[model samples]
Target: MQGSLSEDRRAQGEASAGLIRGELEKVREEGGSGAYGVFGEQRIAAALKRLGCGKEHGVYIGNGFYSVHTGVVCVSGYVTKDELTSEVHGAYAEPQPGTGPCVENRGGH
Candidate 1:
């Protein structure tokens, strides 16, 4: 189960990268300031929702970096037990979604 979950996180994170890149590029094209939250939270949420991972997930984007947090979460600002952050280019995941008190480490903006 853990293996599968990790694989899923990796795959999902990689897959979402392209979408995020496109959105960021669009912002740049539109003359938007190169700043965090430029893409807005609603847009990010909508984009991630398409991935179909319905446990706990979110996205954080800033400057030229982006991170996607999925699995091992129960909702925004919360995490499950056995919380382990498997990071890949700012992205993170876990073997399986736990039920702990792992607050989101959304990084400094």
Candidate 2:
């Protein structure tokens, strides 16, 4: 069961990252928020949650979904921690000023 869960989490992470990369690319090309609206933040948060570990990750996922009403987006596996951190930080920066630059701790326990 533990192994399966780990696999599931890994798959979820990959899927989330993929969606995020595609959306981000489109956002870059279009030079705007695209269809995500305020919810774009949620999508990003979801992707991070899939990869991260902790109760804080759950909080982030909840806020992210609430924030990104558009749809679930993913981050690609190729994305480095730095890139992911920057993207997540940028998404929630303005609306979540109290959150600060949200970076993935990686060593979630």
Candidate 3:
């Protein structure tokens, strides 16, 4: 077993961010639709649900995933997926537009 999981809210957000980053990275490397495809709320939502974060975070997937429980955002940023590198960063409390340069409002309730 992996010792113990972090109960820290920030750490949990990072975990979710990491998953998204990984996906963006793959698409970036492949040089495909990741710029837009990764932004799809449905896909990201499914992935988040599989990660079992929804319950603990009071999560609902729309753009990325935000914590209704803590009022903390777990995912944010955009994916360039072009010749440029994709961007992924920490969550912001004030809801952001998922369609633009942000990721659940992103999925916020």
TM-score of each: 0.36, 0.31, 0.38
Q: CA lDDT of 80 in candidate 2?
A: 24
* Model 1 TM-score, 2 decimals: 0.36
Give the per-residue lDDT of model 1 (tens digit) for 39-100.
Answer: 44444444445655322454443323334554432222211121212233322233212422
Clashing pairs in 1: 80-98, 80-99, 80-100, 81-98, 81-99, 81-100
Candidate 2's error at 89, in angstroms? Answer: 15
Candidate 2 lDDT by residue in tens digits, 1-109: 0112245555654555455565434433443332433235544454444545223333333222322211222121222222222121112222333322232333323
Candidate 3 lDDT by residue in tens digits, 1-109: 0112245756765655676566545544654344344444445444446555454554434433333232343354444433323222333445345322233343536
lDDT (CA) per prediction: 0.38, 0.33, 0.43
Q: After best superposition, candidate 2 residue 80: deviation in angstroms?
A: 14
Candidate 1 local lDDT, residue 75: 23
Q: Point to the candidate with the largest TM-score.
A: 3
